[model samples]
Target chain A: MPTHRRIDVSKVGDVTVVTFLDKKILDETGIQELGAELFSLVEQDNRRSLLLDFADVDFLSSAALGKLITLDRKVKSAQGRLKMCNIKPEILEVFQITKLNKVFDIRAGEAEAIAAF
Target chain B: MTDHISAAGWQRTFELKSDRGASRAVMDVLLEQLGAHDWEPSDIFAIHLAAEEALVNAIIHGNKLDSTKKVHVDCRVSRDHVRIEITDEGQGFDPASVPDCTLEERLEAPSGRGVMLMRSFMTRIAYNAKGNSVVLEKSRAAAAG
Candidate 1:
C-alpha cells in the first residue's frame, strides 16, 4: 500500500531543511500533497536558505515538481535561496526534461548544497 | 453523462481523507486486486495514473485540507473492464478550460498534465457536477485473440 511518507523539517544553522524519507511523496503515485504546506513556509517572513534533502527519494512526479518551483520562486523573491541535495538520477532526469535543472540549485549532496551558499 | 460498469470481479470502497494524498494505500490495494481480475499492465498503469490525478484533485482542490471533508472512491471490475468513481465534498470547476498539455506552450510546466493524461489513458471519462466526482473507465482485453 502507498503511504504518504512523512516529511521532517529542521533548522540547520541558517538553512531550514526538509528531509523526505520515502522515495514517494504522495501515498499512491509519487504525486505530492504537501504543496500548500511548503508554500506556506516560503511565504513566511523570516525566510532562511531552503535546503531540500532527498536522501531517500528515488522518484518525484511533475506535480511535485510544480510545488518545488513554486517554493523556489517564493524564496528567491524574498531574497533567499532554494537549494536541493541528494536527488536520485531517475528523478533528476525528470528535472532535466522540464528545464528545472537550470532553474533550481541542485547539488550532489547536502554538504555541497549547504556549501554552495 | 455519467458512465459506469458493474462487475463482481473486484469490489472495494475506502474513505478517510479530504486530500488525495491520504487515500494512496487504497489505490495500491485496488490496483493489485484489479490485476487479479485479469487487468493488463497497461490497463493497470492507466487506471493508476487516472486515479492518482482524480484523487489528488478531489483532496487538494475539492476538500481543501478540511480533514472533516471526505473523499470517497469506489472500484469495480467486470468481465473485461475496470470502473472507478472518485467523489469529493467541494464545488467542482469547469473542465472546459484546462489547458491541453500536448500543446507546445505547456510541455514544460509542472502541473496540468494530470487531466490531460487521464483523458488520454482512459477509454471513457466523465464528471458529475453536483456531486464533484470524476469517473474513469478502461476496458480489459480477453485472454485469447
Candidate 2:
C-alpha cells in the first residue's frame, strides 16, 4: 500500500476516516498520492466503508473532484461505500454547483458520518 | 472573449511545459498573489479551483500532455475581479461540443466535469476562437452597492 502524505488515514469503530491535511488540493503530486492511498485502503485493507473528513481542506480543484468521483465508483464496485464529512461551505458549494452533492453521501460532521455507517 | 490586461493590476505570465507537474508551481505563485491582495477565503477558493481547471485543461486536453508543447498562463488580479488566461500550443477543440455533466445520463463521465465546474465557480468563462485558450473570471466582491 502507498503511504499518503496529504491525507491522514485512521479508524473510527471499523469505519475508515481519511482526513485531508492540505488546505488546497491543487497540487498534482498530492492529489495522486491521496487517490492511490485511498484506493489501496479500500481494496486491500478490507475497509468497506470510508468517511472522508475534509476539515482541513478549504479548496478543491476540478482534477481532485474527478479523482473523488472515480474513487467513489471504485468503492461501490467493491461493495463498499464512500461518505464525506466536515466539508467547508466553500468546498461544499463546489459539489453543489456541480450537482455532485447527489452522487456521494455527505454528512455534516464526523459523528454524523460515523453514525451513518 | 475578455481582455486580460485592460487596467493597471498585478499581471504575470508564466511559460510552462505541458507536464501536469508544472501546474503546482504555477498555482502556488498565483495563489500567493491572491493572498497578498487579502482576498476572502471563499473568493480564494473559487479563483483557485477555476484556475486549476483551466491549467489542467491546457496541459492535458490542449497540449495532450506532450512535454514538448508549452503552456502560457497570463494572470491579472484586481480589487474587484481575477482574470486568468491559459493558452496551449496544440490543436484546439470546440468548447460548445462539451457534454453537460450535470445531466443524469453523463453524471458518471469524468472528461467533461472539469469544464462544468469551471463554468459553475467562475462568474464568467470564455474560450478563445481556437478554443486552445480559456479565460476564467471571478468576482471578489458583490456588485457595487
Candidate 3:
C-alpha cells in the first residue's frame, strides 16, 4: 500500500523543513494528494526555504517527480529555496534522467543540504 | 502464465487490462515490492516510467485499446536489481523501427518520451520478435530502508 506517514513543516531559525515520511509514491492519485498538501503548506507559510527529507520514502514515480518539480517551483516563487536530503541513489537517478536533478537542490545528506541555503 | 513467476526473494504477477489505471497500479505494486527489497526510489521511478510507456504502447498503439486484449506484468526483485516483464496480447512492433525521442527532429514533440524514459531508467530493455513482450531491468545501489 502507498502510505504517507508524516509531514511536518516547521522553521529552524529561518529555514523551513517539510518532512515527508512515506513508504511509496506512485500513480497520479498519490501525486495529487502530495501536490495538494504542498500547495497548502506553501500558501500558509510564507517562509522562503523548505527541505524535503525522504528518509522514509522507499519508492517514487514519475507522477511524484512531476509533483516535486511543482514543489520546487512553488518554493522558488516564494523566494525560498527547496532542497532534498537523504534521498536514495536510485531515486536520485530518476531526478537526473528527467533533468530534475538540475532543477532541484539535491543533497547527499541533510546537514549539508540544509546549510546550502 | 503461472510458470512465469514463483521464484523466491521477491516476485509478483498481475494481468494487464485495457484500463490505463490498472496498468499504472500494477506497476506501483511491483515497484513497491522491489523497494521492500531495498531498490532505490529513483530506480523504481525509472522502471515505472518505462513500464508506463511500454504499457501505453501496448494499449494505444499495439492493441488499439481493444478491451479483449491483455497485458501481463511480471516482476522480480533482489537487493541490487529489479527486472520486469510486460507482455501484451497484440502484434508486437519492432523497437528498432521507432524514431528516437532524443533526436533533434523529434524533441520538439511530446509523444515519444515513453521509450526514452524507459531506456534511461533501466540498464537493459529489449523486445522480442514476437512483439508480445518487453523486458526491463535496472541495476542500482540498495536503499538503506
Estimate every model's Cα lDDT from 0 to 1: 0.70, 0.82, 0.69
Model 3 C-alpha lDDT per residue in residues B86-113, reported as the tens digit of each score: 8888888777776764454643332444
Decreasing lDDT order of the candidates: 2, 1, 3
Model 1 alpha-carbon drift over 4 Å, by segment: A1-62, A65-117, B1-7, B142-145
Per-residue accuracy of model 2 over B1-145 as CA lDDT, tens digit each: 1334444657878888888677876778778878876787667777777788888888888899898899988888877778888999989989889878888987776557777777877888998898898898887654221
lDDT of 1 by residue, A13-102 (tens): 888788875666545333344765566566643556888999887545557777787787788888888899888765675565455777
Give, for candidate 3 chain B, the lowest lDDT window spanning 10 residues. Answer: B104-113
| Residue runs of model 3 more than 4 Å from their true location after superposition | A1-6, B4-13, B18-70, B74-114, B126-134, B137-145
Q: What lDDT score goes with residue A85 in model 3?
A: 92
* Superposed Cα RMSD, model 1: 7.5
- Candidate 2 regions exceeding 4 Å error are B1-7, B141-145
TM-score of each: 0.58, 0.89, 0.62
Candidate 2 achieves a global lDDT of 0.82
For model 2, residues A9-103, the per-residue Cα lDDT tens digits are 88888898998878878777777877777778877787888999999887777778878988899889999989999998988888888788999
> For all candidates listed, what's the TM-score of chain B alone?
0.84, 0.88, 0.83
Clashes of 1: 2
